[model samples]
Target chain A: MILVLVETDAQGATLVSREALTFARETAARLGDQPVHAAVVAPLEESMATLVMKQLGEQGVAVVHTADDERLTTYAAAAHAAAVVDAVRAEQARMLVAAGTPRGNEVLAHVATRLEVAMAANVVAVDSVEPLVVTRQVLGGSALEEMRLDDAVAVLSVAGHACDPEPAEVPTAPERLGYTPSVTDQDLVARVARTEVTVVDDTAALTGARVVVGAGRGAGGPDGFKDLLELTELLGGALGVSRVVTSLGWRPHHEQVGQTGSRIAPDLYVPCGISGAIQHWAGCQSAKTILAINTDRDAPMVTKAHYAVIGDLHEIVPAINEELRRRK
Target chain B: MANVLVCVKRVPDTAGEVLLSADGLSVDARHVGYTVSPHEECAVELATQVAEATGGRATVLSVGSEDAVEQLRNALAVGCADGVLVEADADLLGPADVAAAVAGVVREREAGGLSYDLVLLGNDAADTGDFQVPVRLAYALGRPVLTGISTCEVQDDRLLARGDGPDGTEVFELPLPAVVAVMEGGVSPRYPSIPGRMKAKRAPVETVALTAARQGSGRVRLKLPPSQPSSVEILGEGPEAAPAVVDLLTRIGVVGR
Candidate 1:
């Protein structure tokens, strides 16, 4: 059996968890239509849990095992991992899959260690089931690696957006089972104590924005971001800056786009003064269209952009803002 | 007072473009320079701060070929008082194997009456992209683990960790002798001064032969993803190009006409 651990938010199962389900469904089909199961470990209300299970069933899950202990009210890697381990044993799962998010990867790592199995992170594809050949992203998605897993139980996390989530042709009302996780006091020692939401600025918008305007070192100084910010507002998009800008203290780290910062997949990305280095490219490579404005035509960003304008961003950004205003 | 251990990996400085080797087994490091990743840099910085705050000493360790000593010495120059090199071919080992090696060191040090109160590592290796080592090591040592922490400090007797989470910035506290994997951007790594460099050069490094099993990641090879083919259309130059840019934006539906 192939089991996927689904992560849920207040709304329901997250997008990445759906993507992992897609991967799991395809992998199950590849393995001669093995049963695909799902395990959800969240401190969810009864209604919310049912909603999540419904979503999972629509994705072709045959059995949905849920952790029912009230002690798991917060995010703790060890306790969640123990819950997954219980589900894995109950279902006799030979393969475990998860989304390659921070929480997903961390939980799976703990599970793999407890099981003493070899696990891979950020896997993009499974080439062969036997001997377990897989392709995964390495170097923060800057490169790809083809690997083989030598463990009896193959454990891997599918890279984010590797495949789009698709509903099963015939939805199955999955059999639901409540599981009691075997957790210890040590497992709860390092759990999340609290969270502080930044009300002053909503940085989550940048990750979910359909349109993003980027600034690099070419933004000059702190005041240089004014034009870019204006253009961002006019386009109804979020503003993103490069690592250098954040390092220079011209922009906050939350606004930085690179390997160490948020990865964005926008419909359109307008980088006004950014030099598209590979580190920054790692974050924005998923953009559908890129338009670069810079004085250096040979810059990496200009070369890779769908459209390029060789000019000083100080003059070009304001002029573009003016044109946008006229059109509005 | 605390004795902290920070683990760092030496990776190719992936700046503009990354090129693969001829056989595709590893990165083409023939021409590119090497440096510890930004995450590891921040981890080292955090380790130093925690040690200094507690009037203790910070030690650095690396499990790699001999070339990794350069990175260890770099950390020593910054603030680490000692260094250890677990001589091994890192390319041939998986995260489990590395974790076993680190766990062995921790056990051996404890036997020798030198115990590390805290262990630090990068959230993920910039080159290998493995996010399992710290957690695996923590499990091996039967200690608590925290991953993706951006800011951390020792508060009295506990470790306070903060990182960006879905709802907001999540905070955590763990007892001493815990493992923490840090991401970059929360702290600035200090540069090595001349005197610090001289002192680091004279510091004696304890080298140990790796005794862990080589459970490789079953990595067959590496290949660069095909670049997106594009023929950039020039939309004129200077502020005069604004109209053309706006036209293109309208064409792409970013701005409605």
Candidate 2:
């Protein structure tokens, strides 16, 4: 059986978790029609648990094992990992899968550690099932690597949006069981003490936006972003920055789009005054169209963009904003 | 006083394009230079700060060929006081193997009466993007571990780690003798001073031979993701390009005509 770790929110199932379930279903098909089970490790209310189980059932999960403990009120990597690991053992799972989110990777890493097994992160494709060959993203999604899991149980995480979620052909109510994970005091040591929401919840906006306007060092300073902000608002899009902008404290970390930041798949990516380095390319490579406006035509962003204008962004951006306003 | 150990990997400077070797097992680094990942650079910086605040010694370690000593020395030049190189064929070792080697070293050091109060590593390697070593190493050493932490400080016997969570900035507290996998961007890494470089060049790095069991990522080969060939269309220059840009945006339905 293939066991998947599902992450839940107020909406019951996160998008990436749904995507993971889809990936698992395909993997199961490739493995001679093995059953796919899911484990949710959170302190969910009874009503919420039922809803999550129903959602999982729709995605073709045969059984939904849930582990809810008072100690798991918050996100703790080790505690959650212990629960997932227990589920895998109880079910005699041959493979463990999860979404490649920060929490997902951390929890799965912990499980892999405890089990003394090898884990593949950000896997995108399943090549063969007998030897368990898979392809995964490396160098922050700028490259791909084909790997084989030679462990007793293969542990891996599907990269975000590797496949879209689809409902099962014959959706049936899944069997729900409560699991009790034996966790030690050491497992709770590195848990989240508290969370401070600093920003105005712009993370989703940036990732979900149809258009994203990226700013780089050419923005000069924090004050230089005024025009860009106006342009973003006018275009009904979100603003993103390069790693250097965040390192320089010109923008918040959430606003940065790069290897260590958010990976955006916007329809149109307008990089103003940004030189597209490999790090930044990792985050924006999925964009459908790229339009670069820079002073240097040879800049990586400009050279790689579908459309390029060799000009100072300060002048070009304002002019474009003006044209947009004039059109409106 | 606390003793800190920061582990760094020697990866190709990926600021430029990545090219694969003919065998596809590794990156073709014949032309490209190598550097530690940004996250590890930040880890080295954090280790230095914690050591300074607690009057401790910061040791840098790497598990790779002798050439990896360059990365260890870079960390030493920045702030690390000591260095250790676990000589191994890194390409053959998996995260589990690397974790075992690191755990062995930590145990040996503890037996020698020199224990590390804290161990630091990059959140993920720039080359392989594996996010397992720190957590696996922590488990092998029977220690608590935190991943993707941007900033952290030692407060008495507890370490305070701050990172970005789904809701907001999550703060984590772990006791001493913990492992932290640092993410870059919280703190700026410092440049090496002349004296620091001279001192690092003279610093003796302890070498340990590694016999790895290589139950790892089981990587077979690497291939570049197919990229769309781009032929950039010049849309005029200067502010004169604005109207044409808006026209294209309208054609793409981003802006209605």
Candidate 3:
């Protein structure tokens, strides 16, 4: 049995957590339909386990456990680690896996320390059975390093953005169970009063939108395009910024999509003025299609893109905006 | 008073584009120099400010090869009162193992009769780029953990913080003895001069807590990473490239004009 934990804030499971569930389900199927269980933590009143089951069941991993303990209002690294350690012990879980997200990596790492076992980070693929072989990316994705793990229980943090999100298909049988760990004075070290979740109340959202419009230093400092809010809203897509825009403080770091920022894998990724640095490419490489609009026809991002438009965005953008409004 | 602990990583300079040795993922000792990552610099910077404001001591800690000594030295240069090198020389562990290594330090430090009122760390190191250590260390130490912190301070009796959220920033106010991971570039770090750097080497740089990597591989060497990238060339046609450009533009919905 491989125990996987899904990290959800007050609103719902995070993007990377969903990917972890997908990874767990696919890995289980390959091993003659071995068991894969998903554990989630939510406020006692909320049915987070049920929420994960709805999504995980569709992918075949239906068994869901929720740590409804009162101590779990906000994510306490200790509390989460204690629960995972118990889950592994109870299931005699063969392996423990987590997404490479900040929270996932942290919680799993804490559990590994408690269990005194060796763990692998940034693993892309896994091959099981008697001393597992895991492939991990090193040197900024410039090289591949294959490592062998010889331990009773293998703990691995799947690289966040290096590998593609695996197919989410699970086995019919799910063994559902939940247990809480004995809290110590130490475990109560961190306290949470409340959690604030950001809801995309705006029309432009990355999840369901097909078109993604972005701006950068090329957008000319968030001022020239006084009607940008209108353009992106009309496109009915979320807005993203390049590293340069964020570095210059023209946009908040949250809006920057790259290896360090958000990894957006939408249907269409429009790169306006982005030169497509390797750091940025690793984040958007999984997108279905890429549309690059850069005056520099020789830009690296333009070459990797599905379609490249060679011209000044300053000259080209106004024309497009006019056409969009004319169509409306 | 806040007793903050910071874990720093010493990586070869990213901006230097330092040549790396091709074997076994080591940076060349000759050309490359190690320093605290920019993100960790912010962590130390914020800690120093908090100590100045609240009347407390900020300590920096690290775990790596003996090369980590240089990182500890760098941290000292930044105004960290003291430093520790875990001297763990092994392949980077997943977050779990790294946190454990840090916990060993906390336990040893705790024996010295000082418990931390807070812990600080960079959101992530640029090299490994793993944003897990701070939060995981908090978990191992049984402390409240906050990752990717944009803002933080200590109030009368509470710890206040702002961490990165989806659409906006989220504010957190907790009791003392919590953990906060500083977001990158949130604050500018201070520079240590020839005087500070030279003085810090002999300054109480302790190895109080060290988990020497389970004596596995003694091999040490680095391979140089490819330094050259494809250069840019203008396709010339200037505005005359418009015809071919318009077709490509219409394909991506950038034009109908």
Clashing pairs in 2: none
User: Model 1, range A218-319, lDDT digits (tens) per residue?
Assistant: 999998888899999999999999999988889878888878787787889999888888889888877889989989999999998988889899999999
lDDT of 3 by residue, A1-328 (tens): 7777776644466556667666765666665677777776545434755555555665566566666577765566667878778777877877788877656766776676678665666667765544467665444443345566666777777775444445453334445566666555555455344545563322114533556766766777857455544556656667777777777777666676665566566767777778776556655665676767787776777777776567776665555566556554
- Which segments of candidate 3 are over 4 A away from where they belong? A8-15, A43-51, A127-129, A137-145, A160-188, A196-210, A222-231, B13-20, B27-36, B64-78, B81-116, B130-132, B139-144, B166-168, B188-257
Candidate 3 RMSD to the correct structure: 5.0
What TM-score quantifies how close candidate 3 is to the native fold?
Answer: 0.79
Question: Tens digit of lDDT per residue, candidate 2, span B129-239?
Answer: 879999989988888999989999998988998988788788998789899999887789999999999999998799998865667558899999887676899999999
CAPRI-style docking class of model 2 based on DockQ: medium
Query: What is residue A239's positional error in candidate 3, in angstroms?
Result: 2.0
Docking class of predicted structure 1: medium
- Which segments of model 1 are wrong by more than 4 Å? A198-203
lDDT of 3 by residue, B65-123 (tens): 77787777777776778887777653645555667788887787789887778888877
* TM-score of chain A in every predicted structure: 0.93, 0.91, 0.85
